[model samples]
Target: MDKRLFKEWESCVKCGICRSVCPVFKEEKSEPYVARGHITLLSELIKGNIDFSEKEAKDYLYKCLLCTTCVESCPNDSHTDTIVEIARHEVIKKHGLPTYKKILSKLLKSRQAMDFAFKSASTFSPIFAKKNNKPRDGIKLRIEVAGKDRLLPPIAKQTFLDKYGNDKKSRVVLFPGCLINYTYTEIGDAFVNILKKLKIDFSVPKKQLCCGAPIYFAGNFEDARYLAEKNIELFLSLNAEHIVVLEPTCASMIKLDYPKLFMYFEDKKWEEKARRVAEKIIDPIKFLFDQTDVLRRLKKLPIRTTYHDPCHLKRALKVKDEPREFLKAISDYTEMKEADRCCGNGGTFSIDYRETSLKIASRKVKNILDTKSEYLATSCSACIMQLADILNLKDHKEIKVYHLLELIDKALEA
Candidate 1:
């Protein structure tokens, strides 16, 4: 009921520019799915005119991707996404997370649990999930994942940390989010390979936990506060000059959200620690791009590549140009339409709202196809997975998807 939440919401002049830009609104074709409609509803909820616990109201609340596009596009800085975050936290505080979310929150907070679950799922994939020979290149699934396609990069039995997290003495800390850690271990390999070529010594601490974005954005603030402690303490203890995060979502969570999380609770000690950690957080792309002669070292590729902007990297962190500059040097690069649009992954949002997620993704696929590029490159692991899956579903499986680090590694080898 605070006035600040209403500050942005009440100021909306009913402009539908948000509808024009929202991937969800474009797909859903409903005002309720757009920022303007959400603002009206949220203002009412904040004022107690509407009950968030209503089943209809509850479903609509979670319908958002928290893509931050509308907030970024808002002329008055309406910050509808921020209101959604606060609303989700309020929902959790009132009725508690669903049973699945509780399980997810627990897993996200515990590295051991995440390691077990992902490793177990990797083990189970061969047994329960159907696989084809061209798994990475987009194989179809009978299980119907993420709307209709169950395609995902094969999970790694050996987590990146399990294999390479022991280089604990280096000046740089490599923080791979859950996807790069478990599902996309090869991305970690690529970063290490590139780092070795750049002669930049780094460490991947085995003790680092989830960046807590998954559960935190899912409405569990308590567990995120706990995770902030473990990760912040561990990173600060190493005295590493830089903490390079693989996934942009993790980077945004640690760099932007963690400080707010601590400040919200008025935990000054932890807030300071959070700020210290935030100071160290850097995108892996920026970290590498900042190095001397990085462009000179990479061998330019003849392969045509296009880039998709992950929402967190493009919007949350305002990281727009560095990746493009690096890519142009390494590959035959062309720009995709709406490069900064969401791939509809939104972590659990894609899982919980599969149909809408895939619909939004389908539009993205059309834009990608228009580029007619041989490869799609991006910074975020989640976007890599989501874009790859959607591309496969659309039968453009031959168009390979890769982490920008992987492309850099390929260039390094050349």
Candidate 2:
């Protein structure tokens, strides 16, 4: 019942407009799974009209994907996603986080822990991970976890961070999140290749850690803030003009969540640093697209492709046109149905709520299939992972899933 979030909850007015656009509601067909229902529940709790046990509140709060569909469609422009985040923080503060979240928080809170876990996974990957090295697919390894296959972009022998140190001459700082640094190093490489092509001098900060999106969404706000502060300090020390991220979710987290996270604290100093860092955060596609002559250098690719809008890329950042405009310039770009719909891969959401995540992702796969395109492209690494999993598990391997950066790099080579 934080006052700021309570105010946002009060603004809902029980309108069902968010229900129409919510991907979870479409799959669950339950009021509890939609934004309106959550707002009503929060309103009731704050007004003393309803009572929920600690477990009950946790249930309602954790069910959300925080994809911002309702936030985008609300008539009053209610901040549903931020409200949901605060609600989760409140619940976790009262009842404590689930075991999985505790583990995730520990790993994400420290770069050393993340590196150790990834390196250990890489050592055992050959036995546990299956390779998918196709040109268009971002899923590099399909590893068996708890008897179910979990998708991961392959880890590099030499991490991007390990390969490059602080460069005083660079104008840009590349913040490779855990995925790009450990799991999908090729995406990091693709980014590096594209930066070289653009003649943009960028440095990969060796001290950069996880973007804390996972921990923040899972209600571990304290740890997320600590990570954010560490990142903010690290990047500011680099004295770079622009801070670029390989993953759209990372960019969204740094740009949006970092400032919001700082709001809960009385310390104004960190908020100022977060705001400065936020101002420098840029999406790679949007940054590259600004270089008009570089776009003209891309060869016309002959392959037919369609785009899947990552929720963070589209809803969080309002980046609907930049990636598309870039794709249309170099390839036969086809628009998929409900391109901006959530693919239900809210990082840990897919792992915690597999059935619902899969159901939503299946529909997205169907939309991709309907376009009859050879490849499906998106800007977020999480969306790429989920779409690749749903596409493969559903026996639609003929269609490859790719990051927009990957395609851009390929077009440069072509």
Candidate 3:
């Protein structure tokens, strides 16, 4: 961790100005859990005045959604995400990770383990999916996680890479991320189809692992760094001109987080390679828009859709307009109020703080419902999962949630 960055981040005024813009604080109604409050605690830790073993400091770091909203809204332009990340790194270094997080990080770093997990999820999906009485009930089903209801999309019968394996098209490498490869392979299929339609050559790297966003958020920086090194080596071997990633979180990790984390890599060439590879990182929706002929072809879908900008994509990476423009080219695109507001699925935050996460997602669902559009399109898989669950719990079945690439693929098919 950079001590200078950590020190500057500790100087937040605790002004509460960011409270109104923070989705987590808005939902939880807790000042200590907000960005300003987290910075205050981090300041204490930085000063060596607080210990990580204390529940107050530990909970303060863990409670943050890491949505980056406060940073975006900060009058001083303080980088809150980096502050939280450094605090998290410090906490993990002191107290170590939880059992589940250790297991998750291990699975994430191992390609074989991830493949097996996806295969198992696809195998057992029918056990969780049941028939219901609504119009889209057959298409959607619920799963219970830690006593909270979650609406899970059925796993695709064939995984994305399996169907597209061995095809050497345009020579680009695909990063499907955990959720897309395991639960929502159809999104991956849509990405592949869109790339194919555009005649962009791409390949799915056989040894791809998790992009490490989950592990990074879980305060396991050691494992996260390991996964980053592994992915950097693998992508370097592929020699693709660009890395097309379907998940915004994964793309953000490769494009932004990794470079920051590996700034002082052992091999100067490795650092250079990682930076060069990061330059080619493109979200699937943005990649599709860059194809002019494809954009012209996409101007034909006749459906009404609204976009929800994922906080990571919109704020962390400043990619708010690309997905919107891509959707506009395909459909009657409507911008919902608070389009940049978070959907409250801050990876493990949704799992650890269920009630708070649900409250945040409820606001997002309300915003989408206000638009009254048929579909709510977003670029992040986790956001899609949380939004779908929130809408289902409200019994709003008419509103469909799709990845931006999925909508684009539908338009091309039409």
lDDT of each: 0.82, 0.79, 0.75
Clashes by residue pair, model 3: 169-201, 170-201, 170-202, 171-201, 171-202, 172-202
Q: For model 2, how does the per-residue alpha-carbon lDDT over 246-313 read when each residue is reduced to its tens digit?
A: 78899999998898888766457887899999998988887787643568788878888999888888
Worst 10 residues of 2 by lDDT: 138-147
Per-residue lDDT of candidate 1, residues 82-193 (tens digit): 6777667777787888878899888888888888898888777766566643315333455655456568667787999998878456688899888888878888899889
Superposed by TM-score, candidate 2 places the C-alpha of residue 203 at a distance from the truth, in angstroms, of 0.8
RMSD of each: 2.2, 2.4, 2.8
**In each prediction, how many residue pairs overlap at the backbone (N, C-alpha, C within less than 3 A)?**
0, 0, 6
> Each candidate's TM vs. the true structure?
0.93, 0.93, 0.91
TM-score pick, better of 1 and 3: 1
* Model 3 misplaced regions, further than 4 Å: 7-14, 128-144, 166-171, 264-271
Model 1: residues >4 Å from true position, as ranges? 1-13, 133-147
Clash pairs (backbone) in predicted model 2: none
